[model samples]
Target: MAVIATPVDATLQVVVQTGTDDGGRPVTRVRSFRNLKPSAVDDDVMAVAKAFANLQAHPVDSIVKVVEIALTEEQ
Candidate 1:
């Protein structure tokens, strides 16, 4: 038997430093862009993330790519 994995969906997340917590720790928030193509290139995704980050009031801390996959047994 063999297993196969298929990409079902994808998302891009931009983590920004909104501010500091009461204890002075950095507070962050995730801005998620859903329905992204799973076949998107890393560089292209990063460019889009940076473009979106520029519009944010806070500075970006990181960029994340989330992909959902479905696994099935090959018949």
Candidate 2:
């Protein structure tokens, strides 16, 4: 994983590449979540879950997405 640090108040964008399932098919699902906590942004649970749900609903083997999370000036 690559980590890029930015200004405290700046928005953070995370580019994630998903892995293929047993069938070796590629997934092409995308989703995003905003106003997330720093820890949630780091973990990216909601965004990941949303992506997985979309992939499952669409029958995709994998998915890649760029999720954006907002950060506050104060920690």
TM-score of each: 0.95, 0.27
Against the correct fold, how does model 2 do in TM-score? 0.27
User: In candidate 2, how many Å is residue 51 off?
Assistant: 9.3
Strongest candidate by lDDT: 1
Q: Report the Cα lDDT for residue 20, model 2.
A: 61
lDDT tens per residue, model 2, 1-75: 444544333223333446567788664544443444444454565466555566443443333333344444533
CA RMSD of all predictions? 0.7, 9.2
**Backbone steric clashes in candidate 1, count:** 0
**lDDT of model 2, residue 18:** 62
Which runs in model 1 stand beyond 4 Å of their true positions? none
Using TM-score as the measure, the top candidate is 1
lDDT tens per residue, model 1, 1-51: 899999999999999999998999999999999999999999999999999
Off by over 4 Å in 2: 1-27, 41-56, 60-75
Predicted structure 1: lDDT: 0.97
